[model samples]
Target: MYTEQGDPCKVLKLINSDIQSPQEGEVLVSMMAAPINPADINMIQGVYPVRPPLPAVAGNEGVGKVIAIGSGVQRLKTGDWVVPGHSGWGTWRTRALASESELIRVPSDVSMATLATMAVTTCTAFRMLKDFASLKEGDVVMQNGGNSGVGKALIQLAKHSGLQTVNVVRDRPDLDQLVTDLKSLGATHVISDAFLRSRDMKEFMKGLPAPKLACNCVGGKATADLLKYLADQGTMVTYGGMSKQPLFIPAGPLIFKDVNLRGFWMTKWNSIRSQEERQAMWDELCDLTRKGVLEAPKHRLVPLQNFEEAISKSMDSFTNEKQILSMGD
Candidate 1:
């Protein structure tokens, strides 16, 4: 646990501790796996908007099996799999105790990685697509950071919903392979930011309709470029600022095109929505995972003891694959 806000590598250290038996309305879980997301890293550095009280646990999302339940617990039982109902549960540990209301039981058979990683990325993608715009089967959706966890989830979920996607990625040495992978995941078009700006880019969209919605994760110029492809009066939703740069959209889109800009934070959504509403969304996303339609992006399973190394890798701008902490049986 960390006592101060600083470099995650320097502040977080491995510690052994004991957890008491479940009290009333509580459940004890043996964590199976958890992902190291960008938000988790930002929270560690004290850069994220939401901060847990000092001496907080390190992770925000993961999947675990219920090993014990207090007398008052009714929704979950021993042997059930569950994800945290809210954020800042300190999920990085091998096991944890949570109130029954703070845990959502899910299918135990779903792939550990998909279930472990789904709570944040897939839920965020679903909400962005469902809430921001009224998209038809053939309507188009475009997004930057196309290879990110949320980006990949959006591609799969969009394809399942019959919406087309134009995905943008940074120029990488494996650009061709990355393009191929994204296409396989349901992206209608996969192009680098440079390619998106090329002369022939407009010509390439001749058949497909202009995108009605755009998901912006990487802000700054990347968002500006993505905005250019949005159809007139389209809505652009900003959920993250990976570029760590200010966003500047020309006044023309806001005034002339009548485009709309909005922002979404899952943390805030969870805080305000009814439990039934949140549970319904979770059930839908988890159902998709069960059916093999939605999958987590490429990830490496790292033992908890190697968390510092995993944190370092996740902080690298060039790292494309996600890192998940494995709580070995």
Candidate 2:
């Protein structure tokens, strides 16, 4: 828990606290694992849009097991595995008293890490694919930040939907290996930001359909590149701005190509969507996971006591592996 917002590694302190019995409509959950997400870091820094009260526990996503359920709790029972139905539930702790409505019970057979991380990245990818455009099999989709957790999900989910993907990542020292890895996850094409802007991109575009939809997580020039190649009347959805730079879109695309620009926030979607709608999406994603169509991104399992190390690794530049805090007994 942290008393004030600041650097997560410096501000977050571990402490023991008494676990309380569930009140009416509440359930006691034993948190199994939670991944260190970029949003979690931003929230601790007090920059994210959603700020829980200060002196708050620090996590927005994780999986837990229902250890006990209080009176009036009907949807979940002991031994049920669950993920937060909404964000900002403070998932860093080993145990929590959560209202039954705050958690969504999930299948117990899936791996703990996948269950912990899927609620955010996988769900975001699923929503974007379904909500933004009327894409068909063999239609093309493009996204920046292709190696990120959400980007990886986009590739796999798009592949499973019978659509092709053009994934863009920052140029790295081990670019060749990264390309191979993304392709192995079903990315149809993986290119660096530099490659996306180069003349050779025209030749590459000739082989694939112009993307009917482009997903932008990294804003600025990378996003603009996506717009340039978008099919006429296509849509571009902005979900994150990792570049910390405002979008500088050319007027031509909107004026001449009839391109559409939009934005999405998973947290906002969760708040506004009906429970049944949310459950349907979760059921579909869980089904895909069980069928081997969706795989967790590369990750390292660190015990909860080693949260400092995990946070440090997560903050490192260009770190690809997710750091999951394992809290299970």
Candidate 3:
């Protein structure tokens, strides 16, 4: 736990504390595994807007098993797998006491890594694709940060819905190999950031319909190039700004093409949507996972005791591997 926010690697430390059995309407969960999300790191550094009180837990999402249920708890039972539906339920630790309402039950058949990760990337991807665009089979959906966790989810989910994706990634040494990997995950087209603005893009897009939906995680020029491919009156939903650059919209698209700019925050969506609405989305995602359709991102599982290494690795900018805290066997 951290008393003050600064650098996550400097401030986060392990501490042992006793946890009592669940109270009324509560459940005791033995955390199985939790992913180290960039948002969790930002929260630890006091950068995220939704700051928990001082002396806060470091993790926001994970999968666990119901070990005990309170007297009034009727929804969960011992051994049922669960994931926190809300934020601020510190999941880095071995166990947590949560209100039954704050937990979402998922099937045990799904891998813990997959379920642990659904709260953020999967949920965000699902919402952006479903809510922001009225897309159907053969529709084109484009997104930047193509190799990111959310971007990976968008690719798979779009394919599952019979939609095609034009994914954009920053140019790198292994660009060709990365393109091959993304294609295996169902990306219809994958291009480097530089290619997004090139005349070659026009040739590549000739046969494809103008993308009716665009997802931007990297702001600045990458986002602007993404907008260039959007169909007339199309919508671009911005969920993250990894480039740390401001999004500048060119007036040509806004005035002549009627493009729409929007922002999405899963945290904000969770706060406002009804429980039923949230569950419905998860239910669909879980079904996809069970059917071997929605795959989890690549991950390195580290024991909780070695979390310092995990935290350090999470701060890397270029790594595609996700860090997961393995509570125990």
Residue runs of model 3 more than 4 Å from their true location after superposition: none
In terms of lDDT, the poorest run of 10 residues in model 3 is 313-322
For each candidate, C-alpha RMSD in Å?
1.0, 0.9, 1.1
* Per-residue lDDT of candidate 1, residues 1-329 (tens digit): 89898899999988899899999999999998999999998998999987999999988999999999888899999999999988888889898988998888888778999988888888999999999999999999999999999999999999999999999999988899999989998898898988888998888877789899999999998777877778899999999999999887988778778888999999999999998999899889888887878987899999999999998988887577899999897
Model 2 C-alpha RMSD to native: 0.9
What total of clashing residue pairs does each candidate reach? 0, 0, 0
lDDT of 1: 0.90
Poorly placed runs, candidate 1 (over 4 Å): none
Full ranking by lDDT: 2, 3, 1
Question: Of the candidates shown, which would achieve the greatest lDDT relative to the real structure?
Answer: 2
Each model's TM-score?
0.98, 0.98, 0.97
Q: What ranges in model 2 sit over 4 Å off? A: none
